[model samples]
Target: MPLPDPSLLFRPLRKLYRRLPLPYALRVLLGRIYRRIGSPVNRAIQQRILANSLFRPPHCHLQESLDSLPDYLFWGVIDWDFRHQRPQHLAEQLSLGGRRVFYISSTLQDDPRAGFALRPLDQTGRLFEVRLFARTAPIIYHIAPDATLACQLRRSIGELLSWANTHQVVSLIQHPFWTPVAGVLPNSRVVYDCMDLHQGFGNNAVELQDLERNLIGAADLTLFASAWLEQHWHQQIPRTPAQQWAVLRNAADFDYFSKPAQHPCQAPDQGPVIGYYGALAHWFDVELLAAIAEAFPHCTILLIGADTARIGARLRHHTNVRLTGEVPYRQLSAYLHAFDVCILPFRIESLTMATNPVKVYEYLSAGKPVVTVDLPELHEFQQQVTIAKDQQAFIDAIARALQAPASSAESRQRQAFAAQQTWQHRVQALLALTEGTQQQPRVSVIVVTYNNLAFTRDCLASLTADPQGQPLEIIVVDNGSSDGSVEFLQQWATSYGQTLILNDSNRGFAAANNQGLALARGEFLALLNNDTQVTAGWARTLRRHLQRNPGLGLIGAVTNNIGNEAKIDIHYQNSQEMAVRARQYTWRHAGLIVPCATLGFFAVMMPRSTYERVGPLDEAFGLGFFEDDDYCRRVEQAGLSCAFAEDVFIHHHLSASFAQMPGKQRQLLFERNKALYEAKWGRPWTPHVAREKP
Candidate 1:
């Protein structure tokens, strides 16, 4: 019998919608429908609004944006109105330099235009305070109750994006509703601030589930609020130069909450106020709270916030306890002013599993003694807060906190502790997420150019000045660049011949990379974008990590306008239109490893062995998207991993090549190539690319 043609096999499966069960088929159809309708419309609107903006000043240079972002920025957005306050402890991380912040939603009051208003549970006072107080860099504490709602609001307010034109750094503290808007920032580099396990919102569970996936696939970088979220997002967004996912966690606000205070007189002189505040729902370990409250009758307990109905009323009857019934944010300090201890009685549900409790930061901010159930995300903060192993241990911890006296030294110690957990510190940690050393490794840097004379010159200058300087070999892959590239390469070749490869046509990313790879003598080869300018020591940092982690086959770095280094481009298009337009500019902060199948011809590195084993990036990938991802998958399948070197960075101007192509032509090539990629991989490019970082 003759073997079946592989292409024919997929031809039949393409009818899965007609043959499969209704629900599964509907899901597939709906997804493609949404992407088609939503993506282009949003992109067009953002482009039109930002077209002539001042942010893209003619004199702006790639190096200038990299240097202007202040290296770090602290950030957070609110999910509920009460949790909407600025996390001061996290903010302290930005003290190293002039820090800057942008809130898609916030409670700061000093500035209105800078802060977006949130639909409050109580729309009572000032709606939401919008503050623009930072002298050099500002902090935006954007809060959104429902991310679904936020997306719609963002579209309504989409034109206001021009306001962000002048800002150096833009971080989107994404709630589910923000995904659509979060994905399309015409003028700003967006960070899909993934701070929690979004799918755990039981009522908003379905929407949350979809939103979580969208944010992971869309945002440029994701800042997980908790370790659980971080690990989860690592699987979703991936960590690579093209994407970034970092764990910033809910951090404490020092000094403001660390001041020593006397206990409140409202509570009958009791043992201690074992308080747990914020939203109360399924995530609240009802049995645990009851067990602790009932097990220890002498301790005075306080429960704050609405939605305490989920916890049984029997626990409410205790004479030693009081439900303060949703206190105002203004009165929170007063309530904490009287508290002896604070507790986080969380249930080990999916939410808790990946949550970085905002109250944890609040409790620490208040300098109140804290005791709570142990969680992986809190392990870093364990030293500062009192952690309980179980019910019995929780009771014991509460007793210890109550007995402890408020002291100046203790307050100073708490403040000191809070100081270490600032957003700047988190940003630094984020920037250095990829563990690569300063020592340079053998590197072959390849730049592919078609036109754009000015961009190619700057990119070359940057490559020549690379700080790592690891026995450098620079090869300019001239893919039929009509302008001065050929002449320029020849002139530079008299001095740099050992490094240049002048190709005749635009043989696409894969073919050109293959051509460059054929001549690469270095252990590691870099496929750089011609429109991009490298920062100091960028190559050395990527080389060090790939060298130390033997299992690593590919490494990517943070770059401007290539989406955040944490999340995939949900709006990813293969056509030239998808590339970063020459006029567009944005900022990126971190780096991470990409596990999904990707087209990484732009800025990536691979060992020569990888090229030999996985074979060159599929030439069928033509000009863009999926080639690098497919190659990386083959590498991972071969027992190697891809890495994102956060510290190493480059500035990429979007869509330099594809930008010149007509829309339909670009779309046709993308679809045809996408079908080919799926045929070889046995799966469409998913949010999670199977990978294990060495």
Candidate 2:
């Protein structure tokens, strides 16, 4: 079989996007501002009206901390809202995994004058957000020499930097565009999730070479969706660090296909149905499918998918072949479930050799036995898939699968194996590719301060007062205070040989804390508020608890000012009073720790591994509010618990920073924060009185 023409497959997509109407120098400026302001509220109350829409983005939800976003900015090989592909599958699963996913649809389906449009994919909001840029191509497959067109596209794309920065997007996973516009996205990593050879693009081969080079050099990891492609890419590019490249095979959306077929349709009762769903492209073996149809004249061959190219008269003329045409990806499960056997007859050509058919895995999820041409890529799925060497074998395999009981152990094994290859599993592997592999420190204590020099001084004094000799590393981040807090802390940290990070202004609690966290080197990180004075041995006690319960993600001490469950019978009159009561409380409840779902970050400690898994605090809450609650919830999602160190006591000067603000501002902040928290977690924040056993 000859190699498929790239122009036939992808050029039209570029044409579609280029026809749609559509930012760049704006990118450089926005990137600069975003680094300072974090994320501005997406207050676009009006939706961009359009003539036609393949998919729409949802209205921006009320601010749910920047931390809640999906770790990736997914740019599908085509529009995500278009045909369901690898990116869409991964994005859907990742979204269900609790990360906000935004699919970049570009402006392919809209008019050149169309404005931006946003609409929720579903009421549950787990379907992922899709946005289309007016005047942009469905997929930018080729690089152009026209800088003006590029600028307009990037300037429009630059608008998303706020989303990128606000979400602290860790990676840009998709096609590479050359410009500072992409550089402005505040993403720590980039992934050229290579599914096909860049050389596959018909035109602009030279430009494609440059683009791939840029992507390869810029990408922290280049994960191939197929093993053959992984090896092919390696042979093309000069060998780099092997760790930077890996194979993350395409998998099915198990949850989607596992759902019993809805609105089931009965096929010809006498004949078994053999189904196939995918674009009828060059890689598809028309001759092979024709032969199968000839050998099994009684079997109904159901071809369910878009006919991207011309279909051969041979298969089209088959009396038993039923071309149901294209349907939405969500509806494909119904067709698959209606089948007794599935087939993936691909031409044994260069185009098919390296391809990994996503639909085959999806078919397996439905327990429809798959018979396919024996290709290198199919070997990976050999355990679950039947290798069809010839027309006779293909016919025999389909007959066997059709004859097998629906609930037979063979069918169950196929389903079980596909379940393990869900988009969730692949997403876990994707995340591993997007993170750095640095050796973390054993323990790092982080403290953020806005003002209140006395509270800050007292807090530091008490923490240092206890000489535990445990190699305790302290990091103090000062969020520009009008008082002499920065200067004093700078000098103090220097004298004590601790780390000090200074910010120009009060960037808010989450931002400041995240900054300190970025600098931390320990395996364990304790977030201590500047207004809290720790008791002697408080750190030692919490660290010991973490050591004892290796599985616990969060361990925080009780304080008189906050944490209803952690509060003891003491309020601070002064720093002197705090010191006295701390010693007394420590003796009263020694070695007592209570397991709880929620804990205060005021003096909470967690392992660096937990931080890596759950990520930094959400900066969207602004100035210091419910981000800690968000953090705890994220920790819980990671299968870890937050426990209170009941035996330990710390003194908290509640609302010390809020004291400087006017009453109205403080109240407004509280109301705003409360609303956001409710929207994100639906927590009522009903203050509970500490319940102590007699």
Candidate 3:
């Protein structure tokens, strides 16, 4: 009657196919065919399997093991037993420092027992390996998850948190797949550990670049593995504070690699032994290896590690080269000791240019002579390591390294340099950065809302999109909305822990803002309109400029739709294009400030001291029109200047509430505000105009 679930027939075939004894090429070809033909059915079966695994209770030992230790959840990009690179090294160091770490692997398992499995990596039980059992592909390869899978993953993570009895964590995310997971974690602080230019990976889709952008925006602290990578991101997203990102380059385990190997690997006794051990993928230089083999006919070119790109075929004919595939991490030191010279022969590409190789640190730690290709990250270590500019130079460097004795003074200097660059030192620096983020200066962002709910929602979304930029204390004042804005504000305020001031009747714009200003408690205060959309790092950029100039009393951001000198002409069709244009504009005008007679109050920031000295907006200009001009005049009268930050951009939907007002009523309100402003200033009011581009 049930039609015997179609997936049941394919399960055994899938298991058998994986276990079949076949050549690497044949296995790959067969796997691709299987995936192509069975994709839809397999996805359905995987969804069913995951659905059944939810709400399962944790093991009895898990609770006791995680007790009393501060927890760190690593949304890992690789399996724990894989390459033993940055992710594994960092987790091990954190665990050694007395923190419990749960590493959720990207490699999934197929088992009927449970939805997930947790196993301790060692006896201390501080480090745990998490394996999610599923038949579908890992979520790391996709830009987003489907609705069904997303619901299951969220519920699964919730169950994990409930079992552990913790409401918050320090989430160290290594890839973009974990971005959505970080959003659902209650009050969790996110750290983005960017180790590579992910778009350069061969198997990854181009869409992952966009996902990485989202993850970077969500992270509280971003750690780049190389100076080049940090500089790359700096040019892409300009105008952020220096404290938001740091270059925590790759390092080695000094004590482990410095000691002599207990059992060294056997090598050819006659000629020199040239060695390299790491992942041999698209970036690996197989042709370079062949050239090296041909140049040194008597040398034994030992190539160790997993050949993921199937490069062994290219070098199989070389008689002197030996490929020992996929060695364990503990056995690497043995091979390093047996080598006469170590060389890194990687292709010159975008991915390899940004790589801060861990093997170089390990090779130097072992007191071996090292020669590497031209990589930007290796420039700092040119004194201790031989950096070659071309293929011929690389080969020559290797010959020189081979001639040098292992116990020379140069070897001791290399070892000394590496001792200071250990995993422990790197971990300590990382922990210090996290601690620094916790002490960020709080900023109060005040937004006054009227009847337009759609604009208000978009404004709040843009404000909170970048949680990593500046710590904000959001205060929202509602001017009696009949369009269900109050109910939405109530729920939003509760969700994000924001302050809401709900007035029973329509309060004038200046008066509503005054209410929020009175309740504000921050070193910096920003006034944002409900119809504006702000760019990332807007507040931090404005705050940095304000702090740098003591004479400046108030600052406003350049916008596309503003009436005064702060307006800048911009061209964009959509939000994504708008963000790109904003970044380009900000980078072009970085640190350039323009003194303005009057800045629009639609978006503005000032220090608390300035606010205290200049005082509040005049409520006499009822509704909205000339309160900003009045405030600017007061700031100048108090012996301070008002300026606009040229490095920041905010998008304004100009006068959303005012546009709805009747023509006669709007004109009357504007004329009344003009008279009140002119009377106070003792002169006729002149409308502001845009400044000429410098």
Q: Pick the candidate with the highest TM-score.
A: 3
lDDT of 1: 0.57
Order the candidates by TM-score, highest first. 3, 2, 1
lDDT of 3: 0.81
lDDT of 2 by residue, 1-694 (tens): 2323424444575476456553556556655775564332211111122222232222455234233243456664566566888877787666666656666663343334322345556455444454535443434565532455444444444444333323234445566543223322321344677776546545433665676665665455678878888777667677544337788888888888977876765665457888888887656778778877787889888887767656645576788887777888778888888888888887786667777889888988987788998889889889889998887888788878778888888788889989998787888887665544522135688889988999999888877774322356889988888798888997998899999988898899899889989989887789898888776556656765675577899998878877467766775577666655554444334345688767777889987789899998999899977787778888998988888976577778787887888999888998898789888886676544575745
What is the per-residue lDDT of model 1 for residues 544-648, given as tens digits with 9 covering 90 to 100? 446546777887764546643432322324323222211121222122234423434467877767766777667878887667667877888888777665434
> What TM-score fits each model?
0.49, 0.55, 0.61
Model 1 lDDT at residue 358: 65
Ranking by lDDT: 3, 2, 1
* Steric overlap count per candidate: 55, 25, 0
Q: What's the CA error at residue 551 for candidate 2, in Å? A: 49
Q: Candidate 3 on 1-694: residue-level lDDT in tens?
A: 2223547768798789888899999998877887887776676665665555433554545533232234678888888988888999999999888777789888655433334667778677667887655445455675465544544454445445445544235778887776665433433456889999988887666666776887775466889999999888877765345337889999999998899899989885467899999988989988888889999988999989888887788888998888899999989999999988999999999999989999999999999999999899999799989998887888998988888876999999999999999999998998888644465567899999998999999999988886445569999999999999999999999999999999998788899999999999988999999999998678877876786688999999999998888888898998778876776566445455789999999999999998899888898888889999999999999999999987688999899989988999999999999998999999999898976777
